[model samples]
Target: MAGQRGTRVAGADLVDLLTRAQRALVRDLGTVLEEEGCTVDQWRVLRALAAEERSMGELAAALEIPHPTLTRVVDALVDSALLYRTQSEEDRRRVSVHVSPLGRTKLNRLESLAAAHERALATRIGPETVTRLTDLLRDLP
Candidate 1:
């Protein structure tokens, strides 16, 4: 029983550490996203849409954003002409999002910025360490 309790406490500590690390990373990336005229959440949506047209539900799941929040984000992006909404030809109830030419231009710029940010992170951590961390993160539960 005592061992189980200790394990639980350690698990909680791990969770707290992960949370802090995630927040700090997001805060750092948020600055670069902001300079590109977007919030991190918005960038996630744009990044997902950059590849191909996706339904609203697809975007929501791909980005792990709640449906309501995604709706607002999609609306704003549409308003800004960064994305276009088209009703699915097979289903009138479904709407798909596609990045416009302007959105593509913006996405290309943001991709460069993100690459530089990633390079800076690798430089700080050492390339081998960054690769190991990336693998570990991919395997995280």
Candidate 2:
């Protein structure tokens, strides 16, 4: 019983540490994206489209953003020529979005940038820390 209590306390502390670490990392990534003239939210959309085409609702849900907010992000990406919208054949009102060639190129660039950042993090935190942190985060609720 005592051992279990200690373990729970340690787990809670680890969660707090992970939360702060994630916030810092995301904030830095946001800065990097802003330098590239896009928000983290917008980059998320680009990343989503890079994988496959999806409707506005699907993209919104995948990104965990509201429909109205997602609409603005989609519009911005569309204006930047990174995404395009098309009507579904089965449902004319259902608009499917796909990443444009330019968007794909940008997505690849972002991936490269992320790799560079990951390497830097590896140097700072060691690969083992990253591996464990990743596993822990994946298991987090």
Candidate 3:
């Protein structure tokens, strides 16, 4: 019983550490993204759609965003002309979102900025450490 309690406490500590690290990383990256007039969530959506179009549900699942919040994000992007929605020809009710040319240009710029931010992080923490940490995180269930 005592051993199980210790393991639970250690698990909680790991969760807290991971959350804090994620928040710090996101906060720093958010500053870089802000220069391009983008938020982290918006950037995530754009990045996900960069390779191919996806239905709202697929995007929500891929990005771990709630459907309603994803809808608002898609609406804002559509209003900005960064993305467009098309109803499936065979399934009228099914709509998929695609990035516009302008959105691609913006995404390119954002990608550059993000790359630089990652490079800076690697430099600060040592590239080897960053690689190891990334691998370790990926190994987590």
Best by lDDT: 3
- What candidate 2 gets wrong by more than 4 Å, as runs, is 1-18
- Number of the candidate with higher lDDT, 1 or 3: 3
Model 3: residue 26 alpha-carbon error in angstroms: 1.0
Per-candidate TM equals 0.88, 0.81, 0.91
Ranked candidates (lDDT, high to low): 3, 1, 2
lDDT (10s digit) by residue, model 3, range 53-136? 999999999999999999998898889899999999999989999999999998999999999999999999999999999999
- Scanning candidate 2 in windows of ten residues, the lowest lDDT window is 2-11
Q: lDDT of each prediction vs. the true structure?
A: 0.87, 0.86, 0.93
Quote the positional error of residue 43 for candidate 1 in Å.
1.3
What is the C-alpha lDDT profile of model 2 across 75-120, one tens digit per residue? Answer: 9999999899999889899999999999988888777777777888
Ten-residue segment with the worst summed lDDT in candidate 3? 2-11
lDDT of 1: 0.87
* CA RMSD of all predictions: 3.0, 3.9, 2.9
Q: Lowest summed lDDT over 10 consecutive residues: which window, candidate 1?
A: 2-11
Predicted model with the maximum TM-score: 3
Q: Could you tell me how far off, in angstroms, the CA of residue 87 lies in candidate 2 after the best superposition?
A: 1.1
